[model samples]
Target: MTRQPFPRLKASAAALLLFGMGALAPGAQAKEAAPLRPQVAAPLSSFDAEVNTFLAAYWRMFPDAAVAAGRYAEAARLPAPTEALRKQQLAFAEQWLQRLAGLNKNTGLSAAQAGDLLLLDNHLQALRWSLTELRSDRWDPTEYNVADPFAQLLNKPDFAPLPQRLKLMDQRLRQVPAYYQAALAKLSEPSPLHLKLAIEQNSGALSLFRDDIPRAIKQAGLKPAEAAAITAHNAKALSALEEFIAGLQKIEKAQAGAGRSFRLGKALFEQKFAYEIQASVDAQTLYQRALAEKEALLQRMSAYADQLWPQCLAGEAVPADRSDKIARVIAKLSERHVAPERFVEDIKAQIPALEKWVVEHDLLTLDPSRPLVVRETPTYMRGVAGASISAPGLMDPKGVTYYNVDPLDKYTPEQAESFLREYNHWVLQVLNIHEAIPGHYVQLLYSNKSPSKVKALFGNGAMVEGWAVYAERMMMESGWGAVDGKPSAEMGLMYAKWNLRVVSNAILDYSVHVLGMSEAEAMNLLQREAFQSHTEATEKWHRAQVSSTQLSSYFAGFSEILALREALKAKQGSDFKLKAFHEEFLSHGSAPVRMVQKLMLGQ
Candidate 1:
């Protein structure tokens, strides 16, 4: 899973004016003022001005995001997730969306500005949909994961003198009680799963306060009195958080159906898929596409398994059943995994090898100066995904990016083995390619160089995830892990299995969220179809419930990006270069593929 920035609340005016007033007024007069000129003919400068105006307002509404994005002028503050703040954000979105709609699209916008317009429109629509339709603050207790903001503030060394940064953090720490209080007031009819997760996650936050905060305080070398004051505030906040978790546990005990339904159903799921993915197709189309891809991937895995069966089994008779053959071959290969204790270290070791391969293959350019640190996953962020890349935000260029891997030490022997088997040696390489190397870490590092901070701040998840999945395949296709300059069938088979996981991720997300697939069916899909272990499947089920449309991102993005590459290859013919294609694709920041394609191809 990709690590997302904490959600920032964007406030707006309480009252929504008529559509044709304010920013829309000038836009509405476009036809009358310049009757013959197309909106596309408008000066590029005008489009840039409009973009600036919109972003200025956006930063005002989401100062927390501004601060996170490295806009110190906005103030170092945490978002106020109060009901009034929600209403304000919704109103702001509606106003801007209408204003954007009123803009002349036929004359003035340059290709880049047009792309930005599409992105901004989708962003506003998504915000509105999230507030009105999803209403996460009301039912999803995980929305109150306060630890992320505080931790983010402390972790990044970008701000200033240690004391100044600590001062800002202390202010945020003091606000934590009110944040949780607002959360308590807003939340109602929460899902049991959400409540449980919130309790566990908040407990993790308490640990952060008890452990990491004190360490950070000492590291900063704050004055004793200042440190004592901060510690007092942190203690108070921790007590409030503990009290809140206890209250949630009490609610869980009292209510039979404690949590609200996690399902988005067909309609809401379609809307979310459209806006979140910004894809050309609808949810049903994407689901069908995923199903076909799953079948195709499984077939490919079966073909590889057929060839490897004799070798893997070491003269043991191959299973007669085709399904059994595939599963057996995978299990045999998984035996080559790292020990549980060495999992994180082993992952770290794979980085340089992958980087060397990328550079040797001339797959993409690398920036040596960008610092990427491999670390254990933070406690609050654990239990959702095994590994994730937490890249530096656009604003914090000097900040270190973390490749967080959840260690296997905490799991039972059986569970740990299952996790290990899922991330077997070969597959782990593919994962490192996806999460680091030429995937998120590299992609995000390039993104920070983008001139458009708007796109950087409001990145498209599909594009981000899709690029990573594409990187996995790209590395393999470029002859990665070839032994003695000869292609290894074992590596190829493992890569195919990893692709199966990607396909299965999309299928599981849609099935669970839209079709309401049961645990038994979901497990069968992951374990049997996707070749995942029981432990991996269980966590994926939880992830699918908590997140919608995200799991599908890898497939949706991979498909779109691949299609773009193929099209470019055909168009450019002999002139087509892989490295150029990769650089150009990522150059557009993390906008939706459609917009990126439009800008790149000049469509």
Candidate 2:
């Protein structure tokens, strides 16, 4: 370690040579055409028209996000896309994907070009899956109402003017009755678990909408007439939404006896697994990997404890009555440096410092275009972000990256300890690594600059998340921890904890859907096996049940990334620049690391 002098953060140029070889190759000259300068600009027209459309539609999906992320202006600009427009947009994507049919994956792409192709493929798969799910599975407005279209609009600041955003909400709400009706009429078979969990999550989240709409209107300071009209509009819309939920709840009982009765047939399940994850590995293979990783991480956890805290004993098999113990252990281990009231404030302070450190230390060459902000998850949808990043849109080369935090503000006073104990300072910093700087947001930001649509579209969960987890591990291994300078070992241990948790998330998904485990049984396993609080465990369990393919992404992606990083190190040998490798790695957006390795290793 001493002789290497490890250059705390320098990037590997070999990666650029490998991934962007065409640009770096003798006389290749083009991709490395020196970024946009004050006096000179890159020719925009040279980018494919379909690529431009890809960027535009990407922003259109979250118009509010585009505004908040500062990609586009709010006034007199493009309307937030309606559902119909979304379909048209998807159709365009389909056409764009087809237009590139015979093109070779490696024809002329810089690494970024290859990444974009991956995005094109994955996004095509995901978008198509979404459409199919809507037509066949439940398309209830409740989840969309709670999750993105409306919730994200309200959550991101300056997304749209109140009236316009309200109009968007009103439209979404107004359509609820019909969408619910459509869902009931068109759903070929009841997804007992999907319906059950989706409805519950929606109903739980609705309370926030109930609380926030008025505040939103009040903050806008519209005239009395404007307020009244908006109120009238929303009242009708809200009434319909309530009725829709009522119907969904009624439907819940309509299929009361069929709890967890749904099974995605082998073909559909296989298709979805492949499409959502971009992994050809079957569910069983994934399950096996998850099982192996879980045990492996458990063993690693034991080893770390043995080395660092020799007195502590972590069991090899399932422990009895250990939630309280784990919680206590995390708190005792974590409280040394965490200042809860000032968590966000501290994180904000660290961003520039980390940015300066990375640059000065010769970390990867990063895009100056992407700017990141650490913001508290709006009181409205913190539950969803729960320490996640709202990724940059493809259209906005320079996008505002949000590091969303779901503070446990609503928890009962008595439950405060449990609510936040999981978020001890070390874990929170590691989480920030996962969501913000050098993690998901960073990965996606560089990906946005990539030229290949398939890379972005077909983002493998394993790749995106694995890189993030790897980022955390990488930083810790290099003796960087606690944005405020603390022992990296604790952060490393906590990273291991979440690594275990990610594996647990995948296993629980397997248990619920494939092994036919009951919700109660699943909940117990989460608390016992994964060490999640009962409440947190229940919330995640619900998420896994409906967000089927998504649950596995965290662990699977992380594992793939780790393997890829090692392979890259081996391949590049003395030429491996950590910073360059990481920067070049992220430049392609999020794809299976195998694909990324091929693209970057000059395969």
Candidate 3:
């Protein structure tokens, strides 16, 4: 299945009592053994049973999601995304939300139980919000893309016996036409940007089925007839998808020059931001903080540029404008990147070195057995990102995690150069640190070990992205690329520029969706202030138009995690251990930083 995007807090007087023990501390074994405490255990057990029942029913509603999460039951088949299914999902969420509300939060609950309860509530709220407020089924054509389920099932080693998985793929493939029909009936007044993305993505889906499916079938060693039948089914599905695309194109042509609104506006943006970020603050607060942080980062970037200006200019006249000066220094640094053809392989080369660094430094513990593979981004999943990690679900921890990097072969030389310049050699290391190494790859392996599947399956995006961003900084601070005995100043400079990109992502997301920022203003913000290349700026503009709130997660989450670390250090004083802090911080699965804080700090 398409990997979900994966989110902070404080020390108080209760913090000492809570964080004094590690996050994985046994829930007072002495108390659990006491005869009288059975009363306490009974209610907690009841809560677990109730929540488990709810989840089973809920997963049945989205069987494809279940399969993606590593559940391989026969019931875990793709369901048609019909309006009836949507209504049923909405009613199911509402019904469970009420039933869960009947459970008392104040009494007879273990810490783990309380945390899981919080997760279930958040999950339900998010489901309700998506169905009722977001209404993606009505307007977002990308929601109907049928290629991902089949691709994920076939591509990943989730099922045993190739034929079993292929049969499941066949089942989903035959239902594609019905799914498309449902989508056609549901989608109306679609956003222009979303429509364009959906078209590109569906076209990529065609490529995926045509080019990738046969290879997968061959690898699976299916019988000749089985392979033929699977091929025919996929061909039919692709044809239906093409017809759906034609329908979408008609809609696009009819609405030409009459740009449908992409903005979520102020109210919806805040609500979605709250649900997605799951932080204490609202969207406006985060936006204002991002603005302030951007200015601070600019000053830091200027100092770093000043240090490198003499070297970069080689005695050429310095620019009078400070922003121009910083840009010049960064441009010089970006000159060291790999060529377009070598991009994917170069990224692959960095992973092992980074893993070595983490191991030598005793940065969080590494799992030698859990495999992480670097591969080209799958066709259908591209257009939105340069790279991403498709992590194994908690239920299927043994599954291979794919770190997908988009290739630069498709772009013209000028475009590819612009893209490469933005992701230079030093920045590439930092990017690897974020997407692989001790970033998404490492964080996710740990996530699979989380005691609570609720937190793992419904992880907070802010926390996930935040940890990756934070990991980039953590590695740099720990002297990741030291030359001889000295740390690499060039790496530090690249990191600062990358952090600026993170902050600007928040600004751009809020501006396009809520502030209604003009193209010129957004471009200037990304290019001039954030030091992004023209190509990167242009794509980010499209990303901002097609998505909302998600761009802000990196900054919002990184900020919260940083604050939590500082608080922990201050509370622990000399007792603080970086390894312990990391292990503890990540122990809560991918729950909101606030929930983690409560669990860790006894709040």
Candidate 4:
């Protein structure tokens, strides 16, 4: 999960609306009337002007995102999530769609501009679809967390002076009550899963008001009266937050077993897959591909298990069942994980080793100046995925990119042990590879450097996630974790099991949302088929319940990226260089793999 500065109101759609629009160079209007050749430049100029206007308006619609993206002018405001704002955003999207359509008919758009046009069109249509169709605001109470933006404002001390930033926080605080009130006004029969998540996350968000804000007030050394006024506003905000959570609890009680299902259902799930993933293939087809890959992975895992059986499980007869045979060997290897206390520490320690390995292998260039900070996941952002990378906004490319690891201190001993085994020594290394190193951290840095802001801002999840999954295999192929120029049977088996999780993610998401796979069946698939630990499987079930289409990102992305590499390699023949391929592919930012394929293959 890529952490953004603001909440994603409707899965990827909100990410597009908020995070995507945040990153393009702030002064795009400067290019609105750049001098152009007589005939060819006129249309492109008009197109540029349209884009500039759209972005300015887009920022107004999502001011918190704008603030995070370094548009400090929006720092003092919070747009109420009310019917008025929804209609305004919908009108904005529709107006831009028509304007873009008019511009696209012009003959002189450069290929890059054409691509940008496509991205903008898709983005607007997605926003419209989200408002009209997905309408998560009506069902997901988690959409309206005011604490996220407030926390970002206070945390970004370098952006402005303390008093000034504090002033902005005070301004935003004034509107918190209205924000939650509007949120409650819109929400009806909220999903039970999301209601619980909103409560848990907001409970943590209350810390910003109760603890962080007071500390900041003291540290800033504000005047007694000013501090008291801010304290009063904070009190009001706190009361509003408590009231909102209570309202959600009331709804939860009233709905009992009658709340909206978290499942997106088949039609909505497929449409969401199209809009969010923007992949070449449909969800069902990709799901079937994952099913086939699952069988292939099992066969490969069985082969490695057979090879290691004598060494790891000495003299014990191999079970006739393929899964049992593989699970036994994995269980033995899982014992080699780090101690519970050292979990986050171990992950931080591996970042450098992985970086060094990638540089030595010439897999990709390492930017020494760009830092990847490893830290505990913030309280409000803790419930989703266990590990995620929060990339710096494109406007602040040099800003810190955090690799957030959920701490294990809260887990029971048994739960921690199960999680540790699932992320054992070998699997842990692969996880680091996926979330950091040449995965998201590297990919996003390159994304920030992408010349096309459209591609950089509105990155395709499949492309971003695919590259990470591909990086794992790429590193392994480049002799990472190998012994005597070949991967050891143990490493090979563990890698297969880890990769199986990616495949199973696609399978699980499709089955649960589209095919109505129950928790029992989902657990069977995760523990029995995928060989996941009990804790890991249980957490995944919750994730699947809360999210749709995201689980499939790993497999969908990995498959497309691998296939694209082979296609490019096939076309280039011996002229292809590994590092060149990686750099060139990532140079396009995180555009959909199919789009990148067209650009790379020049078709």
Candidate 5:
């Protein structure tokens, strides 16, 4: 999943909140131009007006976020991450906190509206905390990338006609130099890890100017002068990135072994978890739960290993050690994986099958009209995770949803073998269930359709990642791995191992950030305990350093969602329907699972 630092506040919602009850507030109407629809709904209107005003300012303040969230008209603007910008953002957040305080004084909010108020409060608070406390902007050069937004425009060409889109791309391209130059000036002693990531990503991103834009220019059939202008802009953009990379390299050389640590430490990790994950429990408590979960998953996997060993290794004797026996069986199964070349091809093929199964089981309604395009992970986005879903903006709901799978063509034979084995045959299907069909793609589609724009736009990470994780368990429990209605032990074993990844992620992140887990310790934890391949463990270690509190989302979200489902089930007894619960839970958009539970239970 992509980690956008700023919240993508809603445009229409802000316009409604700003002018829905009366004329636009001073200096707002000219910027928004949204029609005023005054509501006579008393206190609701009062609260709604406040939300709208906040949204408008938010949209203006973070146009980049707005564009990403589907305000395509704002695509030309690229806000630099400078000190002045951060200060302004800090003040904006503080001012909103006070405004929300005033809104909290009013009474009689519907549960959904009240949830919106909380979302706003948490969003502003998180923004404040990030700027004032976390302060990654000062130390993470990766935070200063221009590649992603550029890729978004070039990849989603249907957003406008060729000429119009090219015009916007040109407009944004001209500003790229200034963007990176400003970033270089502002970056303090940066993280060595993030600097490496920035260099790799920015270098790969040069393909846009070299290959993508030239093709686009030719196809658009621009005049010679217009083409020359774009070509010149591309050169400047390329030079800017090259210069930034050189600057980062110089810093890396000078600050070797002396750069700021990637670890968030205990205090920062807990606060970030509270703000980003928005889980009911603290980070420490969740880490403890994950430990218990790890032990339980091991017991289950060991049982499956015993059952499978006798069948697969009929003549061989089992190892006396429990860990050794399980490892042997998993290794045998891992050898059955596909060739490296078929990695992405295989993923695309399984998507339809996953959708078919979901529909066949009456699990949830699947939208056929919305397109899902499975593509190789773009070079600029490959370092973090192996697979992810990039959904269309709210403005472009009908646009394509990209399922990005990192191809293994670049991996050496050893790396490729280990990577493929990690995501072996059965687990790959489970992965498709998580990253694509009935996972990020489906959940995000539902999020776009949600009535609460606040929940939709300001999505909680735990809730989003959790729903995907929950979908995996939900799919399996609904007999997805059954053959003629009998559960396959192989599928069961693979799933248990896969679920270990979710458990291990929380443990790895918490241990690294808070407990100062060394690479050796983390590797031992993953390879020995979680049964992960060396390749997977290595990438995960890299991910942990670059990102904090994100890994914990899987377990935290899965646990909370399961609790919420059971509570609703017990409340309604026989009346509870799986599809109804799924739709109802998703209908609130992507609010924190806790707030969603309160809304679902009508608290």
Candidate 6:
């Protein structure tokens, strides 16, 4: 098996959004754009050279990753860069930004060519903001000698050999001091709340350090020298770390978990809202729209339930009871749909069918770069029900994409049965389309080799989420959806009903945490609006109280993607190809759905 090289470059979320808008490029405005069409695209970009250079420079910077990235046995022996070298790299970021800013993006080109430039511009813009403005020298507070990824980086068996990857950890660990100092040097006045949250966020990490370090050392099979070195460094870092922790704790105690919420002051709020929508849309206004939409969807879903689930009866349809039915059906279908069992098996079984399906379908342009393996979520992260597709992180030229289903076995057997029955084969199949094939993976795989180095690292969340949700609707229209090709119109309403629920998902986090809505209040809104199960509502309530900006990423992303698709259809006119358009939409790179929308439309 060949190794997938490490992703050397750092990308902000904006760069990623541009790449995600590859074909669309965000500016082509059209009406009634093709929906339910499979999005297979012609392969158009490569990041091999850029990725190789970035990885090489990055490995030079964080040698500990060599082991995790399959480049070395241990970073223990690697020479740690002196403070001089650290300064040199920071300078390099500045020079790179300058160099990037000088590129001539507007050399007469095709519509696609212009879109690529937009991605390029956005990428450089984010790099300038992060490297120069934000100046986040190290990833953040703690440095680990061992590569335990709690972020975008992950474990891919083929990325690098384990021993080689391990070799870089020591070097990375040694740089912790340097990174912390860099963060301090670059630290600007706190954004009032983010600073506080950043501090409070460390609390969990302190416990993690106290518990996770020794285990990591053992798991990594440390030599006495390596072990001793880690222990000594841990001790020294811990002293300073504890001081930092104490300071943070003091601030946090004063705020009482309030500062960490999502109350973006008008200035920050507008910036966030703009980046989120990927078009000219306001966050607060969009949220109000969501609230209204949520009400309508609840009514529609309830009505659909009464008709489809006749047992809901003529008298007194208890929403709690009815909601249980909705959850139960979704849950049951979901239960039977194991990542290892139903999903993977279906992918394999459909190889023959898909071959024919693609050829016969007449809308998609399947690329050979696609090599999929469906699997159950890894043992570590199974708690989140529902599945997700992770596009290749540091493996393969085209990162390996996984259609990960949350295994039902973790639930009680009875729960499992209900889960399976509720989720149903149709819902599971639709979810597959949403996560894999012509959805997230398809979009992300195209995004993997974006020309903009800036975007590869910092792709935004809205585009990622919007495309997947949009695909749900698109797939339903195409015959390649649901277990049964022809689901009843009620199920169609079910899909739309769920689509409207995202509005609540979008703002609930802000409402509860930032708006100071209590869980009881939040739960009531969610229950009344989303028709969510108590369990689901409660889960979201917890998620809302702690998380601030992320829940908004989804709906905002979807709207921007849809907007771009419409624009592209209008610009491309009668000649537009859904397959080609989708492929192109994600090819440019990821950026905020709005920032890249102009590019998506080739404006």
Candidate topping lDDT: 4
Backbone Cα, N, C clashes tallied per candidate: 17, 32, 6, 0, 3, 98
Ranking 1 against 6 by lDDT, winner: 1
Error of 2 at 594 (Å): 2.5
Instruction: Compose the digit string of candidate 6's lDDT tens values, residues 532-566.
Output: 54545655665554334456656766766777778
Off by over 4 Å in 1: 3-46, 72-75, 102-106, 218-225
Deviation from native of the Cα of residue 404 in model 1, angstroms = 0.8
Q: Is candidate 5 or candidate 6 better by lDDT?
A: 5
Query: After TM-score superposition, what is the CA distance of residue 468 in candidate 4 from its true location, in Å?
Result: 1.2
Residue-level lDDT tens digits of model 3 in 82-167: 66776787888789878876763445766666666656665666666667766766667766676655665665564566677777
lDDT, candidates in the order shown: 0.74, 0.54, 0.74, 0.80, 0.78, 0.48
Q: Which portions of model 6 show Cα errors greater than 4 Å?
A: 1-101, 104-160, 173-266, 295-303, 309-363, 366-387, 393-395, 403-429, 449-458, 480-485, 509-516, 564-576, 591-602
Ranking by TM-score: 4, 5, 1, 3, 2, 6
In terms of lDDT, the poorest run of 10 residues in model 1 is 17-26
Better of 3 and 6 by TM-score: 3
lDDT of 1 by residue, 153-226 (tens): 66656666667777877887787777777778877888888788878877877887888877788888877999
At residue 246, give the lDDT of candidate 6. Answer: 63
Q: After best superposition, candidate 6 residue 215: deviation in angstroms?
A: 11
Show where candidate 2 strays beyond 4 Å: 1-47, 52-122, 125-136, 139-143, 146-232, 257-267, 307-361, 365-372, 376-385, 397-399, 451-458, 482-492, 518-536
Clashing pairs in 4: none
Candidate 4, residues 508-578, lDDT tens digits: the string is 99999999999999999999999999999999999898877878878887898899899988999999999
Q: Please give the RMSD to the true structure for each candidate, in Å.
A: 5.0, 9.9, 7.0, 4.7, 6.4, 8.5
User: After aligning candidate 3 to the native by TM-score, how far in Å is the CA of 379 from where it should be?
Assistant: 0.5
